[model samples]
Target: MGERRSTSQSLVSWTRLRPYAMISPAILVFCLFFIYPIGYMVYLSFHDWNFVSPTKEFIGTANFTYLLSNLEFREVIVNSFIYTFFTVFLTIGISLLLALWLNRGGAIYSFLQASIFSPHITSLVSVSMLWMWIMDADYGLLNWALNLIGIESIPWLTSPDYALTSLIMVAVWKGIGFNTLVFIAGLQSIPKDLYEAAELDHTPPWRRFLRITVPMLSPTLFFLTIIGIINSFQVFETINLMTEGGPINSTNTFVYYIYQYGFQFFKIGYASAAGVILLVILSVLTVIYFKVLSKKVHYR
Candidate 1:
């Protein structure tokens, strides 16, 4: 009997390990591609060395110190925060509304879901081009529409005043789909019984949503919020292609700044420092958000 018990335990251990074994390749791939690059970037952050330089000098904290003192860097950091805040909030909130609508269960549900999600799969460069055309003052569809409505043409891509808003609009349009899908999943995950219970208690729709839906969806909301913030901070492609950080760097995001510093200006060491700062900031914010908000999430 003891021998049989020992054999059973061994089998259970193997069963658990087998699944992990299957994923070992994936684990190795991530470590190689993701972790290794990030680790190397961190190591590179401290040095006053570009790969092109004859000798790489380890400057300790000088690169970081220099970056911190740059006014442009500070402005870019503030822009990162502002963009992240607005993008995340707007994306998640609008997505929740659309998700609620899509969760109502009908032909309209499927249609709206498909339509909204279609843009997500579209090419980013193409979307940027399309928005650029739409925002053009003289020959653009938007301006034509505005003229029809007797509204003044707004300088979307050209003017510093409207550049950031145009970018935000594009981002919101692109991001709403994925967040909506997440919300849809979260909404559907709630047990029908809970809503029935709420109904039994004569819970108003708004109260039920606030009390039941909000709590249960907290985990999904929290996850989307983090992801949205991360993506917003890393925004580069649209801004780079559309504005080119023009009109006084009004739309200069952190990642774009990194690209300009490293590739454009060949200040690889300085850019590495900027990247390290962003990594530290993101890591801290993610930890704080999860700590404060995670416990409040109701899986029900």
Candidate 2:
């Protein structure tokens, strides 16, 4: 029996088969939830089909061409890039700082960490509503507090100029908590031995942080950066709920615009085209990022 088992293991390569078989369920789920819909959306992108209509006509790349020509679509694309850039950048930097502060391990650290992470567990719609109330120039908590401190009330969501910024602020505030946790995990993983070695050499705090901490934490930072960018790209519900694309489409993101086209306006085909384009953009950027940054990500 032992010889038979050894022979089977050697011949069948259980190690290789086990790993593949273990992840088969996850792969199946991804195919069902992610790949199939994406493929269908791509197929739909080339045609003109209304959700209510019975027919779908092939228009080749006409839908994409039309989207490119549409001034509003162009603006949406630009807005997506801008929104993604600012929010992801700010989220990473702010989350890192907060993580470092919370990593100090004091009586107040637990309270602060929990408070920051609280929003991450809360519902997005609820969070948006809370911020909407907070940003009210006339009666919102933000402006009311500002008035008490001699600061003037500003139209946060009402003004097109500030609407996008306000949305960005709310997003950053909500997401920073989760990112902070990832960063804290990274910070905690750094060995005390490294810090002790640095201290022996009389390394300054900032220098030790830069030389040891940043390098060691690069893997977590990279992960958070990718996740942050992806989340910011898909920021539809919050903007839709809070501002409904805003005073003049200022906050209409790619996903929200796609949603508006697909479901709201019944332009299913056109929206599918937009979705496929976004998928392509995301896939390309992700590939480039991993190709470039993977080598630099320090993993211990």
Best by TM-score: 2
The models' CA-based lDDT, in order, is 0.88, 0.91
Kindly report which residue pairs in candidate 2 clash with one another: none
Query: How displaced is residue 188 in candidate 2, in Å?
Result: 1.0
Q: 159-240 in candidate 2: lDDT tens per residue?
A: 9899989998998989899999889988999999999999999999999989999999999989988988888889887888
Q: How many steric clashes does model 2 contain?
A: 0
Clashes (backbone N, CA, C under 3 Å), per candidate, total 0, 0
Predicted candidate 1: what Cα RMSD to the true structure? 3.6
Supply the TM-score for candidate 2: 0.91
Off by over 4 Å in 2: 1-25
Residue-by-residue lDDT tens digits, candidate 1, 1-300: 999999999999999999999999999999999999899888888887766888778888888998999988888887788778888899888999999988977887788898999889999999999998998977888888998999988888888788888888899999999999989999998989989999999999999999889998998988898888888889988988899876688889789999998988887788988998999999999999989988887765
TM-scores for all predictions: 0.89, 0.91
| Poorest 10 consecutive residues by lDDT, candidate 1 | 47-56
Q: Cα miss at 143, model 2 (Å)?
A: 1.3
